[model samples]
Target: MPSDKFDVLVIGAGLAGLRCARVLAAAGRDVQVWEAADEVGGRIRTRAIDGFLCDRGFQVLNPAYPELKRAIDISDLRLQPFGAGVAVRRQSGSAVWVHPLREPARVPSMLAHGGVRPAGVLALLRWSLPALRPRALKSSQRQDRSLREGLDRQGVRGELRRVIDQFLAGVVLDDTGATSNAFALLLARVFLLGVPALPSDGMRSLPRQLAAPLGDRIVLQRSALHVESDADGWQVHSPDGVVHATHVVVATDPAAAAALTDVATPPAHGVVTDWWATDQMPPGPAMLWIDSRTDKPGPVINTAVISAAAPTYAPRGHHLIAATALLAPTATPPPEDATRQHAADILGADGRSWTLLTRDVIPEALPAQLPPLRVRQSVRLAAGLWCCGDHRDTASIQGALVSGRRTGEAILRSPARI
Candidate 1:
């Protein structure tokens, strides 16, 4: 027996769940969202302490996110674009500015020096060409190959692989060898289209805004323990009570989604850590720095300065530095002191100079860095059940939003539901 019923029941009040609820609610559907946590936003999290606004992980809003623009009011959030370009610092103690494509005339001359290499210039040309720019392909087709394979086939190597791999790791939070080349290229295309921005307040505001209009319709601290479907419709069991609805959406991470229903396969979970300081550090464009010289087991990618992305993130004169390392399921959490020491070593700072503000280890920060959509299925075994997450597309914020929107639209159009 169900405690309550609605036209649509959504699980996981993150960006995807909230977006689906917002769209269905607007269409006059009786919708309700269940969230395991006390608040919404899922991975897009923010925290304030001692006058510092720190995010769980370093996040940037892509100006070209199609569903984000349509689903949320970006103007209300007042996003601030990055200053100009990203400064890539190499292991050999050399650095270069990768200027945004919008200002091609400003390509830094220093990039042509022996220490600096132009790897993606040719691929950029191909993607920019009128004929090669537009092509239609299914996400599944794009996921059948790894990034390394695709790059080798396309003759992208040496210095180009370094640059692309660094950028891909930063965006997807995984190594290029572990990710899909087509998906990485699609991300690069997004940057070429427009600059990445951050909200005036913080990234968390995006999901909060999406969940706002739903009001009391959203249930918090209620994790959906299980979901079972039959001929009639779907039944979702939460800590609170069971809810019967015409359709069920599991928008949580792959692990949680798998636990709720037997239909989803659990994807790999990665870890990300953020450290905040209230003292001014280096001044430069927001960039991803990879220290190839480090002796760490896995590739350690760090972002030196993000204050430029959103100045309000830190106090007037402070800096926000973030570093992420993908961890295996059997790996143990690195000691806080070790993490701080690693940060200091990478940034060339004395470990004691910076105070650790906030640290979060989202064990499932990202799905396994596989080729795109290889493990994702549009339709699950359950008749009226659907799953949505970054794993379903390109492993990105945009992918999550787009997948959520498409799933919701698909459910609404299903004749079986009518």
Candidate 2:
């Protein structure tokens, strides 16, 4: 309710914004967060419907996410790992099974089943070599090649390219030609380091946990209109009112950030729709399914049934499956019936007995540009203005947290704060 007197004001209550507020508030700064949605957790959202816990998409946190380990109490949540293994069903009616690379014996079986192609295995080896580890870069010289270009340079071929492309589509929700190689490699490193796990409850709980300590410091259902700076400090204008603070952090998706400040460019992509089902599907390990040969230009990268790995997601004897597709710039949300049919067809669940439980189309969810590890400008663009988001670093939950923390640290180090 105050007009202009807080230490910091953060926009967008997504993981990035919440994390920023948490760190600043914990440090004894007067911090406040404004979320356009009635609730926190931006893209990381979950809903409970008809005895099923459904998420906006199939999202999981890698055990190796440094920001998660450092910023939140992982022990407080129930974590479920990927099922025994992952399987990829080809259009030719054959299936490929993929297991964690740590299990050498399983690797043979995976290769034999065509789970991974020979070229993919070789490319993985080449890319995974210690000598190829990512290095720090100056903002001006950071590489911006697409994932496709990176794979091609690594000599990925034939069946292996199809499999790898599909998997990347499912994970990144963008065509390889559109995704940044640097970002893809960063994600690969995270996956290679540990198993991916989901919270037993849902992904939204992660943000809720981060917002717990901030308590009443967070403001929900408030849309930030603009942010401006004067000689004294920064002002954040929201639909409810205006808040002037010593520092302002635009912790939103790239487009939203550009709208609020004078940023020259923002990531381009937007909106993602996901559908969830309960009960009636066959039993199997959770897998990321990439339909490479689909009639569509890009593959339909969706998580097949994951309830097996985390039964707590649904009631006993019920399974939870989710499929997500990115919306094109000119596209609108598909009709409910059409989306349902599309889910069944893509998931290969024609005769299965599953019931459609929840479907959500998040308009303007993810930014378009494949996120760049380093932004052209430092976190502090102005004396009292900062920016942070997945578009600045990695695109996963980990990136948001790390960016937020870095922004907080930058604010603390600034002479303006002192």
Candidate 3:
């Protein structure tokens, strides 16, 4: 069979692949993206189930991400912002803490919860404020430590520490608090500056928006099996046929990239998210509910009334609630019964009547964002081979886009292009 050819070929159609293709194509480089999935948006996909929009997993879009702003029209997404507060479930009940800057009127209500200590507040500020300035977070100036150690060193203990740890465990999918302190602080900076929101349709709209400009340059269901260096540049072997390209970008997930190239396998963090629909109007603002009990009640790290944040997610008269539990890559997903019970306990609601919409078991939800943070890993694999993805960056939508943009810039500057 004849081989198809292009100036550049990008594997995987996730955020990274799409962004890289955009940059290269914009530069007048003949580019084509081969995505393995039937549709685009790898992990950032959504499905309509019984009139409910269920994402591959629970995810939110932050408008503050620079790459996000550059990649799509935020206004077109019709963003639905979450309340800048969280409800912490305790032994007694729940306590809500809203950022005073965003919700000053809620200060009295927050103080009513009674866990905010002056010392903890000051320590938290001391630990996190520096992240606002990129120069302050230079890894060389300070040794990167685990979040637990950083919080302890900064004297962020007791209830404040518990709330932060539990809430972030859901965000990073690591309950051990072993995530890099620098990386965590950067994430905090992002939240501090902007509220996370969902698109009117769902998170899938993001990749779809990014892919719009590329037109038919993207060929779905074309999974690249083996990529080998050839005289012209590289040959990507797919079940359909062989495609030759002057440059190849392995923008797949960490595991797939490792399988296809010489890149080392990085540690992975997994998550199990269960979506349940209920006739009960979930009481409370559009905020995340975190289990902060000293003697934890369930496996769920966090629970939220997603419909409260994105009303379009559920059909009229029904609310959509999501509970997420951190699972090891090899561990069995928690049973639906346990997940439902844990969500109930955290939200202090009766979920007995709620219907389980979907349970997503993602063994590779994210590449572990460990300590000694290297924000920009090398994308070039060899003379003409390259790689880019969340695994190559900070393990977020922002990181993925940034890595892809960087890869495109690097390729444009390379002298090896055919």
Top candidate by TM-score: 3
Work out how many backbone clashes candidate 2 has: 5
Alpha carbon lDDT at 238, candidate 3: 93
TM-scores, one per candidate: 0.87, 0.87, 0.97
Error of 1 at 246 (Å): 2.4
**Please, what are the lDDT tens digits per residue for candidate 1 over residues 53-111?**
77777677887766677888888888878745555445555455555456556565755
Clashing pairs in 3: none
Which candidate wins on lDDT?
3
How many backbone collisions does model 1 have? 1
lDDT (0-100) at residue 164 of candidate 1? 62
Name model 1 segments beyond 4 Å from true: 1-3, 118-120, 123-144, 230-232, 292-299, 334-351, 372-376, 379-381, 415-418
For each candidate, the alpha-carbon lDDT, in order, equals 0.68, 0.69, 0.87
How do all the candidates rank in terms of TM-score, highest first? 3, 2, 1
Residue-wise C-alpha lDDT for candidate 2, range 17-80, written one tens digit per residue? 8887887887777788888888999788888887777887667777777678998999887888
Over the stretch 179-270, how does candidate 3's per-residue lDDT look in tens digits?
98888888888888889899999999999998999999999998888999988899989998888988999998888898899999889899
Predict model 1's lDDT versus the native: 0.68
